[model samples]
Target: MSFNHPTTVLVIGGGAAGIMAAITAAREGAAATILEKNERIGRKILATGNGRCNLTNTDLHLKHYHGQNPKFAYTALTEFNYQNTIDFFANLGIMPKTETGGKVFPFSGQASSVLDVLRFEMEQRKIIVICQADINKIKKTDNNFYATCKDGRKFQANRLILAAGGKASPNLGSNGSGFSLAQSLGHHIIEPFPALVRLQLAESFLKQVQGFKFEGTAEIIVDNKAKARATGEILFTANGISGPPILQLSRKAGEYLQKQLKVWLKLSLINHLSTEQLEQILLKRWHNQPSQSLAFSFTGFIHKRIIPAMLKAAGIEDINKKVSNLSSKEIKQIASILQDWRFQVTGTDSWSAAQVTAGGVAVNEVNPQTLESKKVKGLYLAGEILDIDGDCGGYNLQWAWSSGYIAGKNAAFV
Candidate 1:
């Protein structure tokens, strides 16, 4: 298949970055085309933020982003900041509402809403989107880039922007094929790993507390030292623990696990109170209900189902013993266990379960300012295909928008 007009910019991957890049390129008066491997464009976008589509974050600090050189995102983020993202979407008739942690979502609260507006914009700009067009090879010859698809269809363009995402959520479209495509074209790729994923633990009692959730702080302990920590609602799984806080710290834990280092998860059930404070509270409760069974004494304090497991893990052999029989030393032990519950982290879930990839094409090989390849002129890179990965929330999507804008603008001019 061939286009009637010459394609000025050919964008690979029809994800958040690719869509934005194609739109941005077309907006700059360049004929743009997007070749999506999936049957439909924006399949991944539809899954973001539990279908609500967190567009961007108001608090887009440098610290939230991670990579070999996180500063590489400085230029793109500054050029297309959160306000720019809001304005860009506003033009497409999207009103955004900011939630806690500065997570910005569409007023419609539907990921489909974001995709619909983007599709409308693409139609208005006459951008060509060819879904199920999986390119098998990309070659630059005679000042033009030629992309040959698996079906033997060939496409030629003046410039190419690779926005194919990382390996995370293969079902949603990204399968790390972009890395090989970039590597074939003289770019170095960083080893990719699962990020923002659930972790597996070595504890057998996890099955008992499976599905139990509580608001607490989860800390990543590596080599007997605290490496990272986050506070949020944590849910116990049959295999391990999960939730926002665990996801936040998974990157560090995954890295440590990759290196075969000792890794542990320290959970604080009652983050609001110190260990001493918790001990006093337990003592007071025990005194008020001295006749209450040790297991039943914590009925109102925490989930009844988890109390027995907690008591057992705390070395309490007889959970049926009366609170009056509980010694002061045992009370302190319970308090310490509640505040410093440790679990050996075995590993993280597979790439399919991860929200984003931790590594990709190395940033040093690409120009951060214009999102262009340093080795191949007129070749640009964008989105999670690069090494940059942001924290949970809307930060990753924001990176997509920013990098796509920069790459699209430069690809159009080239």
Candidate 2:
């Protein structure tokens, strides 16, 4: 049932941040209410970590995040950091296991478990939750705020926290509507773009390297200057590239594309060996396999599916050419192909494919310590709706948890 009385703390959006905010307020003995648009809460949380839910990471530094003002994260994170998050979940009866790179997941290995904990906490705290209430407009009064739903449900509160997420994973309910809501309330909305998404390359390069999964570095260069670089497993799809490394830099690639600038992908497919060491290895291999065909010589080292494309890119048409006939220059040419492969990034995948959205309300406008708006009083902001986007790890979720806690804690005390 909808909340019939005045809400002391009204938190919008039922995802990670909103729920946490409501919980914090209710636990502090405030009348807290959450208005969620989805059929239920935590739809996006269920999709995190491929259903395992990477809750938080141990390796958190300013380098792992990007925005107009990355320093804003320091205050919120300092107030409630990684260990606090681990303890927060632990108190909820969840035992978390850490994987490589400090990614923490529940021992149960289900996102539903995390969501259930959140549900259980809300029930315990007696926080009023109204689902399927699509917020249409938010208005501010001299004393309080009023959130009007499209279904004619109006909620009044002394304080309002807008945790509506960014324009990513629209199927999961973040359709960028939060931007408009903030803009309507006399707040500036920064231009939003797709982040942590796959990149579509030039058709020719994709056709040659489709389905090639390898470990290496992917660099996004704009106007001949390197913008961002990441190292991880990069997988090529039929049309583009996905995987941690590519998705890490795709946001910058998309931003540069919109500026009508040249963006190129410089890849180092094999990272372990130096260029000289790779050339030396190639020289010895060519000498040792003098009688084998060019195609046969690469059989042991490279996959059969990728050899043709690699050979073709190296300008070697004669796959059957005997190794003895291959010159030192030809071997070096093949080695260079592996070390330095470049492709022009045409664009990034749309919001439907992106994991997060880059750019939102400017960080400087929000008080990082309290997550309250500097311009709009009693209106706190959290989650992906802000001008903050973290890397592929658990940084985003950490921001949601920390910011939600701060906003919730203060929204009640205010």
Candidate 3:
């Protein structure tokens, strides 16, 4: 049972990748249609960058991404990389501003503007966008794909591009629908997990200082070996840790969690000094400020809010205790606490808070150059669905543009 219609291309998913694919296919002389399960296209776009989409990064690098095959993204990424993304948005009349660390934000600081530009491009090109259409299954016959919706509607096309995102951010309509479709078609899926998310800490003191934020370095240890580390401003949550540094390290921590392995998160509140160096410095400080209380002496070296805790950790019960009266071992303990304040990460925040998913449709089943499926003809993979994900600061969005562009261009041909 099928309501077959003549179309050159059918693109599923209406996020950044699907919309881009629709625009490119239409521009390349194909009758393109986009099927979005949600009521609106680009639902996730609104949540990006806290309402202002960090569209892309001025700094693009391979090191920002993760996958079983790290090299799998090279071709498509190179084909429609960062500059291409900037040009595409610029052509739409959106002037992006570069913020700290090369993050690019729209000058208007509105994600809706980015969505409008994309929607306008589609409208100008006469691309059909169908909303609230949940594609139940994709059945391929010879040279055509028949996409049957859950509501009993069916769409037929000579070519199909699956730009459906990963399992993360389900409220945005990315709840692993793409995975179900890909699996039905015999595509290998690299087990999906949350990435670019905040980690849930085992310690409860994080709640007492939930809103507190500070610049620190976080190191990840997997089975006692240093796995990864990041340095940035981190925010304490009621049950966990969130922020740039913690988010970046959370990816590896999630992977380790999936493997049933234990991971340790070490936090360095004072990153510039080693324990021994700090100890020596503190000893010298005692000589320099003999009459100063231990807590008072730490005022210049550490944040005032955390000074009491540091002192307590150093076995200093009396806040007004003179630095000169502190024992040698107590001084060393204080120095150690200053250098390394460790935290244990038991898990991560749910997928809703995650910026991107770690795994998706296996890259091995898709052509790295064209983003076309090696297993299914006329089937293409893009965005977070292709086992390609990047770090925060706009790299993931860059992947969306690059993969979407390639899939759209190729799906339009033949």
lDDT against the true structure, per candidate, is 0.92, 0.87, 0.86
Ranking by TM-score: 1, 2, 3
Q: What would the per-residue lDDT of candidate 1 be over residues 1-414, giving only the tens digit for each residue?
A: 134454499999999999999999887878999999999999999999999999999998999999889999999999999999999999999999999999999999999999999999999999999989988899999889999999999999999999999999998888888999999999998888899999999987888889999999999998789999999999999898899999999998988887889899998998999777888888899889899999999988999989988888788999999999988778878898899988899999999999999989999999889999999988999999999999999999999999999999888874
Task: List clash counts for every candidate, in order.
Answer: 0, 0, 0
Q: Give the TM-score of candidate 1.
A: 0.96
Using TM-score as the measure, which candidate wins?
1
Misplaced by over 4 Å in model 1 are: 1-7
Each candidate structure's TM-score, on Cα atoms with residue i matched to residue i, is 0.96, 0.94, 0.92
Worst 10 residues of 1 by lDDT: 1-10
- Residue runs of model 3 more than 4 Å from their true location after superposition: 1-7, 274-277, 284-301, 308-322
Tell me how far the alpha carbon of residue 243 in candidate 3 is from the true structure, in angstroms, after superposition.
1.4
Q: What residue runs in model 2 are displaced by over 4 Å at the alpha carbon? A: 1-7, 205-209, 317-320
What tens-digit string does per-residue lDDT give for candidate 2 at 13-101? 99988988898888776788889999999898899989989999998787877788888888888888999999999999889999998
Error of 1 at 275 (Å): 1.7
Tell me, by lDDT, which candidate is best.
1
